[model samples]
Target chain A: MGSETESARRLLTGWGRTAPSAAEVIRPATTEALVSALSRRPARGVIARGLGRSYGDVAQNGGGTVLDMTGLDAIHAFDPDQGTITVAAGCSLAALLDRVVAAGWFLPVTPGTRFVTVGGAIACDVHGKNHHRDGSFGEHVTALTLLTASGDMLDLTPEGTPDEFWATVGGLGLTGIVISATIQLLRVDSSAIRVDTERTADLAETFAKLRASDDTYRYSVAWLDCAAAGRLGRGIAIQGDHATRDEVDSVPPVPGLKPRISSPRWLSLAPILRSPAISILNEVHFRRARTAAGQIEAIEPFFYPLDAVGDWNRMYGRGGFLQYQFVVPLDREDVVHTALELLHRERIRSTLAVLKRFGPGSRAPLSFPMLGWTLALDIALPAPRAARVLAAIDEHVAESGGRVYLAKDSRLRQELVDVMNPRLPEWNTVRRRLDPDGVFQQDLARRLGLTGASP
Target chain B: MNDAFGLPSRIVVLGGGSEIGQAIVAAIVAEKPADVVLAGRTPVTLPDVPAARSLERIEFDATATESHGAFFDSLFAAGDVDLVVLAFGVVGEQAVAEQDPAAAVEIAMTNYVGAVSSLTHVSTRLAAQGHGTIVVLSSVAGQKARRSNSVYGSSKAGLDAFTEGLQLASLGTGVGVIHVRPGFVKTKMTANLKAAPFATTAEAVATAVVAELGKGNRTVWVPAILRPVMWLIRAMPPRVLRSL
Candidate 1:
């Protein structure tokens, strides 16, 4: 019984690696064992943890048991005709993508990295660049098995447990642990993306072109100039959609089963971790993209450009980094401009700043996305008075009824969260039903007093 | 997962205020602890347990047999419980017990009948959940009845047998019962008594329980050598054993 999992008390930290906490971690091999552990009613409580990619303490439970769900990774069911896969919550997107891609199917939504788990994606309701075209990750999920605190398993679907299901999605793993899920996948002819690259002269051009033609592209994302003096926000806008069989034919096939132009590996490029380094790289990258470029690229490089470099997170240095993502209504385009200027004025440097348009607010109350523009900025940790900078930006957002992403936030004030998520009361009603005893808890929940685990 | 020292994560000691039970909880938590639920009749004094996120103290009366079902149902419904320590028992003075049949019955009911009621509920709940361990604190006093504490001995003897039955019944269910027998342990229950030959301390009993749990043993005789020594005690002539 004292195997690798036993006697191995590890210091667990979220993906940000900022706030580390010691915890007893157990990996249950089967669904029954997992349920038993959950049903035991430990005083410290337990929370299901996946790959821990959240840039905050959402996955860590200080002085509690963190159920390492990664061990329960299983591709349980797959129906080729339906183009859907029923998989364990712990199955990583990378693994699922590999299997489905070979079968001419692709994930309905994928974040910037392919390392996230289905459970984490659902808990965070992770939104990808194509959220404007489709929706957040939760929209495609047809059904999932929710194991409540009482150890009873509930088959929750978009229809079966409407309120509970939506509440579970983006509910921050507080309602219950996602045992397994069946999600709809998009069909694709080939494993490639047809991309068009355009260099925006300034923020004006970028927003104009994006707002004008975002509907044309299934996926679109812009790499912004975080350190621009005169031409701030001038960078590259990359737009793409799954390549059809005809487009695949138009682009000459690589000789001898090899890609003609091997996808550019991010590692081949010089490290751009520091603010100054990123500024120079952005300048050069922007200049190179002044001319329009169109190419057929592998699906991976196009969707998960950062995944090409293993341990890319280390680039943020030992201090780690924070991904502060916020969304303001479309009518408040001024909020987006004011926000970039505020970061510049505050002298808070962000190495990677991205701007994307969201189609409409998701039905999931706590979800990060809503109609209008969402800006995600990755700022290195230990920035001076980080709280102040975030609070200032949050004020600008809150005034316009905008909200920050809970999955990525580490410093959002409790009161601020209450004000931001208006659907909190509705979500709480359903949450209490799933975990009435407040058995499921984590560091994030404890800090914010979510799920009544505070006492 | 056990603690960094490889102790279990969540453990509930039924006799919340029992010195020996508290010692076991302290020892386990001191080494490795995620949560500790000390359930007993009295409010517990929590140890300096920084590693545990929660040290829940619940008022649990062992003689309340009728409430065992709802108590355990609520406990299981609350959260994930990994291990349960059935450590509630009392040794009524043999003189007082023999003089008053009611006193003897009270001793028997609290020590034997109460445990049966609690353990039965625990066994069923854990088995239904498909995982967990129930560690019952039996005693070597049950190995053979001496005149001085025959009443206590008889109670433990009944508990030992009941636990054995539950252990066998739990096979393949993932839930298991462990019977732990300590010989004349110097605890609060035996504070003023003369130390018997080979008598152990509560701390020693706690250490043994922790070690046995690590080994996943179904039966543990504290001061491990007692396994063979008890055989000799059982074989001793009743005349000689009674004299001692």
Candidate 2:
């Protein structure tokens, strides 16, 4: 057994703050060891983490041991005929994408960042731009291996253990330790994206174009300028889908097509993140988007722009930042405009503001996306006055029948959570049955009362 | 003092003037425990400890064992006492203890026997409730009987062992016992002791304990490395262990 160390007790709560404490952190190398360790001491609460990408406390359990699942990453099996791959929970989506794309197969869905673990994706029920066309990553999952509180390993799927399986899909690691999973992969023609990029003058124009053009494309997303008021939500909208080999010949060859190249590490640092610097950069970026032109672009550049900057999260400074992502129904498009108008009126300087239209809801009850338009903003923390502004926005979202993404939430109040996601109680019930001892608990759980278990 | 579960949790610290106890209470208060009770023999003389608005105070005496049961029963009858922090004990000179056995016995009973009786009553109620956490303050000196302070160390050792056994027996039933083994802390109790290596302040210990409580830890050694140090000490021969 490895000795618990203070250095291992550090965690990056969704707000990007490294909360340090003294804990007996245990990194189990194998599923057997993980089960034995859990059965032996039965941690008061345990949270599983991989690459620490979560913007909030979903992966952080104060004072409790965090099961760092990254070490358990290992590709187990691949069935070419079925286009399915089975891998340990800790295997990164980036690694899988690289390998799968080489074989003409691609992940059915991927979040903006490819560095997240499969288990992390399932836990958060992550959605991508294509969510309007396809569903969440949970929809592509075929089966999972779960280590329950009783130290029993259960293989679950939609058919076998439907309730437990669906619960675990978006259960946020509260159900059990996900050891491995078999996921069905989508076949693609090439590694290129057939893209059409356009810039709109304001919120109205952007919404009009998105609603009209989204049906023609498999992937659609927009970057809104939250800092702009009367013409709030004005920004660029990009739409794309997998390109066939024939389409690439008519367009200029895309640059930097490989996925393995490491993005420059210093781009996210404070030296470039200052408000004035960001504003200047945004102006240049807006000027570059002159027309609705089609281009052949590398999939890496199209989906994961930030991936080009390694460790980009560090750019937010030591205090870290909060990634506030909330969605409103299609009918509440006016609310989205109002939200943007408020941000612009407040002159709140956000680093990045993304808008996407969600296609449909998944089987997971608490999954984030639905038939709505989602807007996500990244704001730096320690903004003493920003909390009030965010609370105002939260009220707007709740009134509009929208909810904030739990995976990205850090500073939201418990009261807001209770009202936003009415399914929380049902999710808690399923969670309690799997982890009867309340072993899988975290700061998020404690704050939001996710675990019905006391204290 | 609420149990680990924080249900029916009502903690009352007898040493209202103790900095260590006050810090522990402050940490416990953050858990949103049902209630907190601060008490002392001379409750009127005791200075106000920073407490949650939900916390209350009353008169308590460690030596008054005759009324201890009834006093606890009344509190329980009002509500359940999930946890009780027995943070009332004395630290005195080894020379004084050796010269006067009566004074030594009083100190020993207050630190050990008195704590045992009170904790036993609280533990029984918690066991009935089927969930709780008891935070007991034990000292690192109890890792081994020290020539400098064997009497006090022995008392802590007895309390530590009892708490460990209690924790073990309560397992599977939801009741938890946390044995807090802090090194020399700059509390009112250790104000006269020479500053030692790795000594922490009461607030630091309190913070560590609170963090550990959230994690549902059974045993915690402040400056955590002491757990290994204690293990090494236990593995050493008697002659070597004593000399060290």
Instruction: Specify the highest-TM-score model's number.
Output: 2
Instruction: Give the clashing pairs for model 1.
Output: A39-B79, A40-B79, A40-B80, A40-B81, A41-B79, A41-B80, A41-B81, B16-B40
lDDT of 2 by residue, B1-244 (tens): 2211222235667666677888887766554433567777777766554545355667887777777898778776664354567788777788889899997898788888878887888777755543456788888878887777888888899888888888777654445577899888887677778866678888888877666442233688887888898888778899886775
Candidate 1 lDDT, tens digit per residue, A254-304?
Answer: 112112233334532333477777677767766776545458888666776
What is the DockQ score, from 0 to 1, of model 1? 0.01
DockQ, per-model, please?
Answer: 0.01, 0.03
Q: Where in model 2 is the C-alpha error above 4 Å?
A: A1-8, A11-15, A18-22, A249-271, A453-455, B1-244
lDDT of 1 by residue, B64-132 (tens): 888888888878676546578888888788999989999999889888999999988887775544345
Each model's fraction of native contacts: 0.00, 0.00
Error of model 1, residue A371, in angstroms: 0.6
Alpha carbon lDDT of residue A238, candidate 1? 88
Docking quality class, candidate 2:
incorrect
Runs with alpha carbons beyond 4 Å of true place in candidate 1:
A1-7, A249-272, A452-455, B1-244
